[model samples]
Target chain A: MNRTFRNMLLTLCTISLMAGLSWADTLKVGVQAPITGSYANEGQGIENGVRLLASQINAAGGVLGKQIEVIPCDDQGTAMAAAICAKDLVNKGVSMVIGSYTSTCAQAAQKTYFNAGVIQTSDGTADSLTENGYWTFLRNSFPNSAEGEFAANYMVNVKKYKRIVVLSDFSTYADGLGNATEAAIKKLGGNVVSRDKIKADSQNFTPVLTNVKSKNPDVIFFAGYYSDGGQLRAQQMALGIKADFIGGDANDNPDFIKLAGSAAEGAFIINVPSPDVLPYPIAKSFIADYQKTYGEMPPSIWGLMNIDGMRAIIHAMEQNKSFDTKKAVDYLHNLQTPIDGITGPIAFAKDGNRKGGAYVVKKIQADGTYFNEYVQ
Target chain B: MDIFLQQLANGLTIGSMFALVALGYTMVYGVMKLINFAHGDMVAASAFVGLTIYTQIMGQAASLAAVIVIFLLTAAVMACIGIILERVAYRPLREAPRLSAVVSALGASLVIQNGIMLIWGPRMKIFPELVPQVYWDFGGVVISLIQVIILALSLFLMVSLYLFVEKTRMGAAIRASSIDQDAARLMGINVNSIIMIIFIIGSSLGAVGGLFIGLYYRGITFNMGWQYGLYAFIAAIIGGIGNIPGAMLGGMLLGLFNAFIAGYISSTWADAFTFILLILILIVRPTGLLGERVAEKV
Candidate 1:
């Protein structure tokens, strides 16, 4: 054959192979959460956020000119169910996943995503989850790293707390908050006069209150969910122990106000910076669109992550010009866009966490509503 | 020393709450030879009732009459639930294999919690604190007022129950029924009524436990009953399966064991310690603190 013909044939062969290997034809992402179990109500909000974002992206000519398909996987809010969902999503060739809202579920699926070489971002903040890797997982921008300094900084520096009593459920998730806040308290030259660990599901914290009372701490720092935090506050006030009950992101739930009733007033939390509370211009439009479609405000914790994740994925696909895993990931690492992302035009850190991150302070209002008080 | 005593005093109050709930398990199992696995949900149900009443009675100051009325209402309403559950669930399967009844009880429990969720909603509602957490200290041992009352109330119930069982005619009938249902039936005692009564009493006790649980803990939920219920059931079994006094002893032992273990060792091992203690007791005593020696028949 002539040299020119030989080179042309070789070029044609390479181009054909490249065309065949391009994964743009099937742009696939998986969104996972519990459609059942304890967190189902909250999970619905998360699913809605991501789904709506994906829909918006698809409406905008789809990712890389191919239709973006988001596969919904049910974690059932349990570890085992989440692992099963992870395995299925991996098998379906999903290059990216947003999933498994609770820490326990996230833990179960982390290994699966890690092994499958799929990137995942979860709404859960258990201390151990994203500690190991940058490739395998990302949290909703906020990691447990914030809870330590955030809680203490708010109470000690912002709220000017001095004598504090720390209450913890000692759960896999809240333990981080507890350890963090306690250390922060000590670091600020303030002391933890009392510390008590309760069963995670404990309804009564009165006995602990007595121990707390002896310490006479001005603030009662509780690291757990709304149910326990609010209940502890209500019970303490009913007894008139009068310590300002403080907590982490768990307190940023309306359920705390409902549970604490009149006692919920002035209770403080270090929390996720809300889509509603963000000073960024995108929050207003996002909230309006969310309320218009879903008939409610965006959910407190898990919702924004999924929305931001979908935006990230779609943006990555657009930048890569293909939906192939390697290209999409590389795009994710490099692509930057001013998306009106729910958690404030989120930028990822080198470790793929949200840049300019996490809420430092929130307050529970009189009517059982939570509002962000400070964001940096 | 002060902190140590104070924590013990604090834990004792929690132990008292455990005892109050454990009584229902012990009493129900003592006569019926059934686990009454639903006893925990029964606690949830009664708490719901109190919570509903608390909502109604909000903005009002605490009164002795109001307290008595609420307690009586809780007992009566829960007694009815207990009786109905027993009639529909237990009596039909009295002659059948025991496992079926236990399974049915579990179903009933699941149904009850779900029913509450349906009737109410999935969101956990906080019941108003029934006990005012007034603190009273003796030297260094600080006792919350709720703890004092739970200790007093549980003791009052226990002493009265012991006296009634040991000294009253109906109590004799109950004891007779517990010992031998067939014998009690042959002696013209309505064994069915006795069983119904047992259910009512056990559930009423659970109802009070539930009410006190609200005042003591201040948070009530659809599933709050299970944690305490599991511990109560374990206490019942470890204290010789169906012995009343044994259940009480077992609860105290378990509580003390947990507190000491958490204090002495890693707090994480407290659960393991309690379970290990149960297994050890099961091996050594088989029956427990007040449990009767049952001769294994060859």
Candidate 2:
């Protein structure tokens, strides 16, 4: 009996050794997202998109002749958790990371990835994300400055509304977007009556709305995530506020309509083309493939954008014919040809911010569908 | 003037909910002298439970009968949970150090909060509108039908609780146990039963508050308890930790203070102003406005 037990132990040791050896031949990609917190839906969508892409690449003979292994770390949509996840992923020896849907999380993990010389890409649109000259970090989505300009133009030129009220929560992303939009509005000689800040998840905005109501603004622009955005819209409608409600990029989620109920109708949301509205054939096919694998469509355009980031990084690596992050980073910085992405032609500027942002002003229809009212 | 009236109406609507939640804290602290830190999470859990029951019973059209049934069923289920929490977390530490029970209460709060998050999947659930959206404009101060219903129901509950605690034979026993547990036991009153009764009343009131919030706010999340619970805790303290009427007054004052601060000043400073007010009150009154200076029993 003792001899048999010893033999079993020896077999387990050999199996584990073989497993460890095979891991060395695989390309490890880390995903840092808010997998289980207030932003769980977006975080889970990013994880699903990256994992699906990894499996597809593996099935097609992998990247750099190595099987792709995806490692996911849940940042829970907080800066502290994102920093911890950055350390964890770095310790796990990941060559690249595609993740962290929110800008604050991405910014928190930015320095860590830069120090470790790991290529990191995310859908966070906060303007400060790429401002620090982090060679290791690339923004998958357009910065808030771009969207802010588009929103200002739409409000000033297209819709021609006066007395705009810019509202935002205390998050780094929302507050920055609010500032950008407010500044852009002023630049265009548009009248911004009030710039208000709200405590996120307070579930009570009546006081602020009451104050805004007195201003008699024609437009109320809320730059916050869908969680608070929907509530703000619903409450605004309930209070009989006559202003036209326009939500910023972060408010473009199905849950927003769900939370807003019937009040969602006639509300406008400004963002890049939604996942279903993308005109690219590759976008359509990848979305179809994602739906087939995950049994649900991608949560929003953010997830597909992150997947595009992953595809861009892999394309750069294939062009350089190497897994060295430094070479891939250099290739990505000055790509002679833009890579076709699920969003659009993916290209990065010298500052690591995505180049050429296209935005649309989509109004919510009675049936809870978004109608593209104007495009820029 | 119209804006002032509207702000006042908003303050009262929010204060009604705070007052309801504050009662649970005051009642539990009154009996055991142990603050049930789990009270806020209990309110959140009850709201989720209420949501489930509400969805099941609510048809294409909502009825007054169905709404009452939802409230009662949620309260009953939450009362059972409160009893279980007391048994598992507090009862064991009853004879232990007071700080141990407080720590245990905090632990229970975490467990319930995380459990709700796991069950509900961290997404905010929208509460179905049970009443028709009818707004009554009072010379620019618009009041929704739902807001009126909330105020009326909360007032009813608070009055019922006050009467039950002041006028009934069980009320006397409860007061006795709270004042001196050993004396009450020697007087042939079952102190354990009184404690159990306190949990039931406190949990039920909190459950109703949960329902009211879900109906009023229309958006509920797993960790929502911490925010509302903290406000309600402050409300309880401001009113006097062991007094019922104190909670009601405290909640209203805090609500008014918050509304005025957010309106006249800035929303960013409202929370900071609330904390400052709390600190000032603590320094000035110490025992709270309604709290009496009771000598420690030898």
Candidate 3:
């Protein structure tokens, strides 16, 4: 009797194991972000956005009726760590990966994702990221060069500034935008009075500002992160230079106005349209839900981009009726209609760069508030 | 000529800050013969302490009285921290091999830096604008009122420090201890207290430098100490590491060189060129410009 009972238990266990193998109904998505280190705030913001998207998707019966699982891997804001994260996620058999705010980390993971045949939707904005012809790599954010051109055009054509001086931190992102803006300004028949580069950790800009004052430019275009941008704005005012300060997405943070204080007033910033500017019900609902869950407004409008990226992949999976990376890549590449993004309608160009991504021109108000001045 | 004057003002302003921080390095090395690598980190800590006092405690009021209070409180807190660090980290290793003490100093620097990072997080904070900004334009050469105050304050502090080191009984005790620790102890001098006082004085000067940096830059970061510390160390070495006045001179000269290079050449080359000039100076005069020629007493 004991032998018969043991054999029956073994038979039941074998059948359950076979069922588990055949009926796997979970999709693993990898989240690569610098969840710690210098860019931890940005990484946390991106991670929160991705998690919000996943929860919303899961609550509404999920994609293809399979539960979505997020495998978080902190890239620590470095390329080497990003590459390792991509490899680790690939080894975990994740269908796709989303991540990485900085271009350096995204570019580092490019070949790894490409070789592993995983679709990587990154927010990195370097133009060279897409120029490499990686079929699996698609960027959700607009290129820095595009932002640079937009800034130059806005200053010269719209604001009607003729004499422009450029300052950059010489990081890949800053230099790219600075050089591109300089080129575009000259292309549009505007004068570039002087160009200067500041080191990353420099706190004092008096000598540089003094030199800039000597040139007497009408508009000073700064292309660095908000920390230095704010410092420069304050120093410019302190030195009595009357040039208008303008910068790229790096200066979009609220901290810019606080640091620059009264000096930040009238300064223009070009970045992706913030969530506050999004008028669509979809965007509104996402914001409300995100705030309800996370206890804050989305860290930045880039949170919307991350949501749209996740939606694009989930929508593709739903269309394909299976979790296939190849089909998702194909769907993103040969898209006939635009995917509704909180930022705007998201569609990929031939190079897998998002086509409908728009730059919003924002001006800092006198009372340290931002108002949308223009959108393109 | 206007540009030269403007650069000169810039050099003097920056030089004063460097000199203030270099004094700390010079004093500690003078007494202990140990490079307190953590000296720079102390400056950074003082900045954060001053920031916390302004924002959290003082409710972000931009008054001169608040600034004075914060400066004094920050200096006092930093002095206590310096004393504790010396007692715990340096004093135990006083008799150990100098390499062990050096390693301990590096470890102490990491602890302080990371400890501050953990408390404040890694965001760059804008220092409160207590002093109203006013520029003083002399024809084409523009200088800020803050620049004048910074220069005056730095010179006053350096002079006061020089007097304290040269004139008082405690000053004589400190000088005696630095010259011959065992002999000073045998002659009834409280060698430990003298060293403690040295740390206190050095750290207080560092606190002042940190406060000025926050005011001048209007922004401070957790890792700012590393850059400022490196520059101050170079300044101390260039002025003769153990010589107090040498440190002040070294800092001012380094600041002048930096400003001139940035004004005339490229800002990118300012740091590289400064180091290159230092190497050249060292090659020419191994004992530095004001370094004394003291024979081995042993």
Candidate 4:
């Protein structure tokens, strides 16, 4: 009776092991984002978008004849937390990572993903993110330099602002954009009256605004996140500074309107075409499905851009019929035809930066809706 | 000259809030020789509680009467929390080593900060406009109505606290306990009750600071306590850790330093310059500007 029981247990164990092996055949995609922190709205949007796209792909047919498994890690919008998330995700055996709303978090986790041979696609726009020449790193969004050039041309040529004051928080992305814009303005012979830095989330920009007002600036360009951007606009108005307020790409968030309140009106935000404004059918359908699923629009263009990055990576994998990182990177770098992305045609430069820049300057109307003023 | 005046006005507005928060640190340290690291988080939590009361209970009412009512209710709730925190986190460890209590305080700080983050969902909440946007421009120096009210309210609270601590019988008990807990206890004073009272006053004052910040800045986050708390802590130390009036002076001085430094020098160097000045002050006056030098008891 004992021998018979042992044989029966062995047989059951073997069958369960086989079932586990079949279940484990699925591909793992990691999402590293600030799912909970000051930038929680943006992080949550990215997570939601990635999940929505993954589900749609799975519904049609699993990737490579296997289901796509999503493993999400919340970086808390901090560099330290992002480093830990990167390690955690890599240890989970993910082949690719779609993540990190902020440039600081993305840059923090960049090396870890590279060392582990995992492909990482981020919406972080810092120019330095691609400067390291990390093959594993791909930027879904255009670099700060691209936006800077566009902003400089518009401010100098189109608007013809005489005294422009540049403001930024002490974050990697904001500082980079601020410097880039400042340099671009100087290059175009535009007078940058003052360059100032504000402590992010300090909740008070009056001191800085007052100082800027003293300079008699014609326009004030703030290169910072929406959290600070919105407050800056509100305080700028409170201080009765009549200068035109322009916000960088990071200011393209719904909360900017809510936080700035009525001050959001007449403020201008420069960013890549917002998700809702994308003319691509793929973008529209994806947005509709996302809205149907999440019951709200994606927080900003960053979420959709991240989704497009994921789509492009998966498409490259499908083209090559391989899950290898090296093969996918090569395919993405030298595409015969650019994959149709929600934001635009998805292509990458040699240094992993996104090819082409299509930024739009949108004016915040009185009703808290964006009016596309100019597209470049 | 206009910029200087405007910067000064801005300095005073921020300094008042810092002074209010510094009072909490000073009071708690005065009575119990322990630095309540969690005091800042308490302020943040109170602001959130105030937000809830304003939105849910008050139905987003913007009347001055409703604002005052909300402030009182929020203070009361924070006082209760303060009492509970003292009992659970500090009371048992009171007999332990000083470092142990400090560690416990740090732990409490983390617990409260994370607890708030978990509860509030870690997003920056926009504080609705409690006061109408009205600016008073004095020859290029703009001062808003809310700024005036904040200055008035902060000054009123600080003066009231000063009077209470100086004149009231319970205030006498608190001062006595701070001077010598054992002696005060022997003198028929309930030291435990005195400590509880100190927590109540400190927490309530910090709560008001939180509300003031929320109303003024219009942005409240879960971890904002760390930054604001650090500034207030520095203020308390600069004024002399256990000195109430010193905290006030320190806060105002710090605020002025920040504004002037940012206006005249560089905004990025304001914090760095402040720290250097703090070091200079400590080297010159070990007990702070107003801190009385008391010989250590053997």
Instruction: For model 3, state the Cα shift of residue A146 in Å.
Output: 2.3
DockQ (C-alpha) of model 1?
A: 0.16
lDDT by residue (A191-266, candidate 3, tens digit) is 8999899875587777788899889889889988776788888888877788888877877776678778767889
lDDT tens digits by residue: candidate 1, B1-298: 7656755755566566676678788877778888888889988889888777756764444666677778888899999999999988888989989999899989988988888877766545656545554666576455666677777887788778778777999988988988898888899998888888888878888888888877765666677678889887777777776777777777766666656666555455767888898888879988876789989789
Best-performing candidate as measured by lDDT: 4
| Model 3 chain B lDDT-worst window of ten | B122-131
The global C-alpha lDDT for each of the candidates, from Candidate 1 onward, is: 0.73, 0.90, 0.85, 0.91
lDDT of 3 by residue, B112-223 (tens): 9988888987666777677777787788777777788899999999999999989999989988988889999999999899999999999999999999998888777777
Distance from true position, residue A265, model 3, in Å? Answer: 1.1
Considering DockQ, where higher is better, how would the candidates rank from best to worst?
A: 2, 4, 3, 1
lDDT of 3 at B101: 96
Q: Tens-digit lDDT track for model 4 on B1-298?
A: 9988999999999999999999999999999999999999999998999999999999997898999999999999999999999999999998899999999999999999999988887878888888888899888889999889988988998889889989999889989999999999999999998889989999999999999988887778898899999999999999999998999999999998898888788778888998998999899988888888988789
Candidate 2 TM-score for chain A: 0.95
Q: Return the lDDT, model 2, position B250.
A: 89
True contacts kept of 4: 0.64
Compute the lDDT of residue B297 as modeled in candidate 3: 72
Native contacts conserved, per model: 0.17, 0.64, 0.50, 0.64
DockQ of candidate 4 (2 decimals): 0.60
- After best superposition, candidate 3 residue B217: deviation in angstroms? 1.9
How far is each candidate from the true structure, as Cα RMSD in Å?
A: 8.5, 2.9, 5.1, 3.4
Worst 10 residues of 3 chain A by lDDT: A18-27
- Which stretches of candidate 4 lie above 4 Å from their native place? A1-23
